[model samples]
Every structure is written in structure tokens, then in C-alpha cells.
Target: MTNASLTDAQLARSIALEAGALLQAIRARGDASGKALGDIGDREANTLIVARLREARPDDFILSEEALDDQARCAASRVWIVDPLDGTREYAEGIDDWAVHIGLAIDGRPRIGSVAVPARGAVHTTDDVHLPLPAAANPPRMVVSRSRAPEIAKTVALAMGTPMIAMGSAGAKAMAVVDGRAEIYLHDGGQYEWDNCAPAAVALASGLHASRIDGSPLVYNCADPLLPDLLICRPELAETVLAAIARAR
Candidate 1:
């Protein structure tokens, strides 16, 4: 599609949906396994998504989680930050937490984005979306990873005085906040840009707040490419979340 024909928001959703469909097909086959699963899926998804983005928006630079980091993207005013599959491990294990994330970072900030979780049959766009909340009426819940729930995160949950639920996938955890399944999603320790970009964008666009633990804004298309920390929460809990991070540290 021509740049003139597709707006940035539309393109972001299209890419995310396309990638999500591909991931669904892969998951259906049930072949994703071992080291090979991640390596193969990462390579294929990265190439496919990047090529499509480049073809659709030839003028804009692209920074992808699975692809090689290009220093030129740093200088580009607009770039596409993508993670074809944000939670490959979850996908490989037949878990439904995985999602396709596509974000358009303009001037180093994610201005628009989309995330599609095929397993959940849900697509979150920049506009007209509401977060899902738990049955309990309260301040909101916090969701962490089942396998990677660290003490630091638990401490944060306690400090915030919010209930914690363990889930899989970074995108899924963030979506919990977006859909009202939870109020806060914070993780520290080994996470890359692709893992959080699309979800972060969608959360921000939907009027939720996503940032680092310190509450600073998140900047994409950096040289390092590895985004090791994140804090996704509702606006009302921003101060408490930041304080929880400080206490945990």
C-alpha cells in the first residue's frame, strides 16, 4: 500500500495483524520447539515484517527486535519499531499470551501502534478500545509472568497494595493494564525493544501510562536495542508505581 493510501495508524495495525496471522499459523502447526523454535521463528518473522514495512514505507527507517540494529535509524526522524511476535516463548509453549506488536516511533516517541493477540482473538488499536477489568471492584490488578516472577516484582506489588496475577508474555502483561485485567505490569531484567514497543504504544494511545520504573518516558530506536525494564500502569497509580520501584531497588 502507498504511504498516501495508508495512514501511520492504519499501517501499524495492518502490520501487526499480518504478523499476528502468521504467528497463528505457526502456532497451529505446533512445530515451534527448543532453541530451534526461537531461532527459526525469530528469523522468519523479522525478515517478513521488515520487508513488508520497508516496501510499504520506503522512506521511513525501520528498527526491529529480531533484525540487525541499523545506526541510521537513530538519525531518522520517523521509524517503525516492531516485534513480529512479542512472546515467542509463550507461543512455542502453546500459551496464549503472545502477540504481534507494531509501533511507529516518530521523533523517538511511539505516536501510534497496534497489537494483535490471535490466541485471544483480540486486536487493540490506537482508538476506540477499552481495557478489560477483573470481576473485583478495586484499584486494579497487577499481572506478572508465571515463569519469571521475581522477588523485586512481588515486592513492588506488595508496596503498591494491589493484587498480583501471574501471566505469560510481555505483551499480555501490558494488555492486562490496557484491557483492565490488571492495573500495573512492571518487569526488570532482560527484555528487548521488540518485546514492549507495540504494547507500550497501544497502552499510551489508549490513555494508559507505560514507561520505565522511574516513570520516565520510553524512547525507541536506540543503539542498544535491548530494553531491559518497563512499567505499564494506569494513570491514577503512576506515583505509587514509581514509589514501588524505588522501594524495590
Candidate 2:
């Protein structure tokens, strides 16, 4: 794809906003019963977003959480990694923490990304756009899964002298840092590449630190495609957070 046609940032923002609208439509229907919300909404959102992407950028390949695993993406140097709805549980529960994530992986690294949180009426991007950074000395706040807060996360929060804020959706948690709603977002449990790619890209673009516990960078568009852990914190708190995770390990 030529750079002039659609910039990475522009594509990411477009996909994110479109998917977010789909998610909101599903939520408005109020069919949150027997996992109906998750099933119907996630599938619809995924299908619509993928279709839109294919139409918008036919030359580019895609790797999405809801689609069948495509080995073809592994060969493509530039691919779009997406999670149409990153927080099904929260969405089903009628919570506003769910988000739509769209990321572009160039050379196996998330180089451009966007996340849209409909409930919060917020859209985030990792482009040239500048969002004000939160105060550096503010007390660190750790965000973990509302349904599945791992003991390790709690332990690390205590070790870091911060409070643990229970939230839903990996993408939304990462955006909390971007919006200055929280200071840290960490998870050691299993997560797919689609789950982290867009949010990680946005965080990295916004000048935040996002990587593995050992401080390794997060890479996408891999064959295995499953990412088990992530650590996203403000730059000032990166060292301290990494040390805490190291001690816990």
C-alpha cells in the first residue's frame, strides 16, 4: 500500500471509530442476557469492522481476534491486527469500559494504532496527535481486570505503593493511562496479539512505556500470535514497575 493513499494513523482512527459505532449499536439493543450480548455484539462488530477494512484497504491483510487464523498474515510485512470488541464481559454487563481496538503492525511491531471507548466517549490514537501527559508525580494507579484480577497484580500494586483499580477490557485499561485516568496497566494472564496490539501501539505512540515484564518490547503479526503478558505504565514509573514484577516473579 502506498503511504499517500491512507496513512497508518488515519487508517487506525477510521477503523476504531467505525467499530466503536457498531459496538454502541449492539449495546443500545439491550440484549444482555445469557451471554447474548457478547455473542451477537462481538460477532457483528468483528464482521463489520473486517468487511470495512477489506473494502478500505484491499491490498493489506488482516489478523483479527474473531476471524479464523490466517497464516497468510505471517508473510505480509504490514498487516492490520484488530480486536473488534476488547471487553465482552463488560459489554454484556452493561459497563462502559469496553473498547474497539485497531492496530497496524509494520515489520512485526505495532507502529500505528487507535482505540475507541464508546461508553467514555473517548477516542485515542498513536499518531502525531498530542494528548497532554498526566502529572508525573501523581500516585501510581494500577488497572486490572474486573472479572479476573490476578493475585500477582494485586501483589504488585501493593509493592508499588499504588491502589488497584478494577476495570474491564485490556484495551480500555491501557487507554486509562493515555487519558490520565490511571497510571499503570499490567496483566500476566494469557492474551492474544489482537488484544494488545492496538492499545500497545497507541500507548507507545503517546510516549508511554508498554512491554513485557522483563522490559522487552511487544511484537505483533507473529505465527504463534498468543501474548501472555503486558506491562504499561507511565515512563517515570517504568523502572519501579518492572522491578516489582521482577521481584514477584
Candidate 3:
């Protein structure tokens, strides 16, 4: 589609879905785990997404995990930051929790985004926004990294008296909040712009609270994209989660 015909949200969703399909096809070839599989997927998906965004919105700055860092984006008002393959480890290990991320930050704020879970045949985006999520079941459920559940996340969960759900990928965990599968997704270990921009956009669109663990707004398209922490959760739980995080810190 032409640039004039597609809105930023639509472009984000389309590119993410297309790249996810490409990754799924590549993975269907056979069992190629570890670095080899991860490399192929990351390279191919990044190429597909970058080519499509460049063709569609050549004027917009683009930042991607698989691409070289370009400081020029910091000066541009609109930047598309993406993770061609979030959860590469899970993907390479033949897990279904990996995802493709496409996000557009306008004036350094996440404005539009989409997350594609190819294995699940689902794509969550800011275009078709959902109302506030219902409260999660009793005790509440917290999503955390399967391989490395950060101590801070554990501490928050304990403080809230919630149970933790092991998940793979930043996108997957964040989307879980959007899907109502979990009440909260808190990460403090570390992350970059490409890792959470799209997920944060989607979460915000879904009427959830998306911000830094300290309850600050998430800013993107920075010269240095090393965003260290994120918190996405239902509004009702935001106070408790942030409080727990603050107390733990």
C-alpha cells in the first residue's frame, strides 16, 4: 500500500505481520536451533521489515535491533523502532513465545505499534484499540522472564502477594498483559527501545498502564536506546506494583 493510504498504526501492523510470516516460514524448514537458527531468523526478518518500512515511509527514521545504530533518528520527529525477532533464544529453541515488533515513536513517545505472535496467529496493535482490561483472577498473575526472573520482579510479586508466570520474550510478556492472560509484566534487568516500544504502544492502546518501573512515561528514539526497565499492567494494579517496586529498590 502507498504511504498516503496507510496510517502509522496500519503500517506497523502490516509490517509486523509480514515479517512474522517470513520468520514462521523460515522456521518451518527444519530444526535448526541455537545460534544458526537465531541468526537466520533475525537477519531475514530484519531485512524484510526494514525493506518494507523504507519503501513505505522513506522519510521516517528507522531503528531496529538487527540494524546498525543511527544517531540521526534522535533529531527526527518520527522514528520507527522495531525488533525483527524478539525472544530469539526461545525462537531458536523451538519455542512459540517469540514475536515480531513494529513501533512508531512520534516526538519521542510511542504512538503506534503492533506485536505479531506468528505461532499463535495473533497480532496486537494500537489501531483497533481495546477497552480497559478486566481485573485478573484472584491472587493476580505476574509475567516474568522464563530464563531469568529478575530479583526485583520476584520482590514485587511477593510484595503484591501474586504468583509469577514464566514467559519468553519481552514482546510476549507485554502482550500477555494486553491479552488479559496476566495482570502485570515488570522487567528491571534491562531492555532497549526496540525491545519494548511496540509492546508498550500496544499495552497503552489496550487501556493498560505502560511506563518505567518508577511510573515514568516511556520515551523512545533516543540517541542511546538502552531503556533499562518497563512496567505494563492493569490500572488498578499500577499503584501496588509501582509501590512494591519502589520499596524493593
Candidate 4:
């Protein structure tokens, strides 16, 4: 229960798992539905995560989707960028792909992180490198937003002759690549730091290449906190995917 006894990776995983578990409990109760369910999940999970982080790392800064932005985090060296209850809509609808994210950005780099898909009972973290990721499918598979697949993603998939699979949440799409359910996660739509930081950290540690779609490094803890797009994919496919993104754009 003490921060001194827990490594950053361990802390990230534990926090994410805890928040995911809380989310599961709330959903199981079924007192709310639609936006109400999402609101309750977001509020309760954020409260738990923020309180835990403050207690464990009092000096560290926090950036959470459900909490008010603290612009001061832009100046801090260690910032916990998190999505307390990612895929709120999916979660509201009882979808299995929604997740909880806990990420640490040290010196504007994703240093430690975890993403827990509670419904799927899977936790991917920077602490674990030996996860049995399935082999990449033939021609590769792409994971995208179920409601709005980016046109660039379509172009890339067409260029590679792969099938596109619709999914919910940025975390879910990124984890799909991390767990080997898919080979590519290209998001050109707008997103905030909380949306991708934790997922990026876990993906990078998993040996997948994670970066801005243009292949630039993903710098975090910025003043605006709006990261427009990112690409997470198999290492072997990073170059090809970046190139395709360039051509498509």
C-alpha cells in the first residue's frame, strides 16, 4: 500500500486493475443505464484512481479524463495521465472492450502504464513482456472505431489488403494490437493525452511500435493535452504503416 514498496510498473498495473474492478462492480449493480451508467462509472472510478494516486504519490501530478485539467502538469517531470473509465459509451452499453488506464509519463515520455479491460478480464501492462500474444494474422488486421473508422485507416488497410475490425475505445484498439488480436491501430481522429498515454506505454513495452501517426515521438504532459492521433502496430509494420499514413494523408 506504500509507494516506496511498489515499482512504477507495478503501481500502474495495480491502479488500473483496481479501477477496472470498481467499474465491474458498478456495472453489475445495474442501477443506471445509457449515459447514466457511463456517468456513474466515470465519476466513481476517477474518484478511486485519483485518491489512490494522491495517497501513493503525493508529489506527482495527475491528468485524468474525468477530472479537471491541471495545466501545471505540463511543467512536472512525473505526471500520471489516465483514463479512469475509458470507452464509457461501450461500458454503458455493456460492451466487453471498454477499459481502465493508468499511465506514468516521466519527462514527457511514457515510462510506465497499464490498461485493464474488465469485461474481458485482461490486464496488459508495461510490467509484463511475456504475454502470449498471438501471431499476427495474414495480411494484418486493423482495429478502428466502430462508429467512425478513419479514412486514413481505410486507405492503409486497402493498401495492405487486410480486413478492418470495428471496436470501441482507443484503449481497446491499441490493446488489440498489443495482445495480437490485430496488427495495426491507426487513429487520425482527435484524442486527448488520457486517451492514449497509458495504452502507448503498454504497447511500447510489449515491443509494439507506438508513436504519432507521422512517426514522431509521442511527447506527453503538454499544456493542451490534446494528442490528435497516434499509431500502434507490430514493430515490423511501423515503417510500412507510417509510410502508408504519409501517402494517404
lDDT (CA) for every model shown?
0.79, 0.86, 0.91, 0.90
- Candidate 3 per-residue lDDT over residues 10-106, each given as its tens digit: 9888888889999999888976768899999999999999898988888988999999988988899999999999999999988999999999999
Q: Score candidate 1 by lDDT.
A: 0.79
RMSD vs true structure, all candidates: 2.4, 2.2, 1.2, 1.3
Candidate 2 residue lDDT tens string, 1-249:
633367778878877887788778877877665488788878998898888778777878899888898798888988999998898888888888999998889999988889999888888888757767968545678899988887778889887788888999998899988888899899987799999999999899888999987899898888999898999889888998899888988
lDDT tens digits, residues 122-156, model 4?
99889885666677788999999998898999999
- Tell me model 4's lDDT, rounded to 2 decimals: 0.90
| Candidate 4 positional error at 194, Å | 0.3
Off by over 4 Å in 3: 1-4
Which pairs clash (backbone N, Cα, C closer than 3 Å) in model 1? 131-178, 131-179, 132-179, 132-180, 133-180, 141-183
Q: How close is candidate 4 to the true structure, as a TM-score?
A: 0.96
* Highest-scoring model, lDDT: 3
Backbone clash pairs for candidate 2 read none
Residue 207: error of model 1 in Å? Answer: 1.1
- Residue 48 miss distance in model 1 (angstroms): 2.2
Query: Clashing residue pairs in candidate 3, if any?
Result: none
Whichever of 2 and 4 has more TM-score, that candidate is: 4
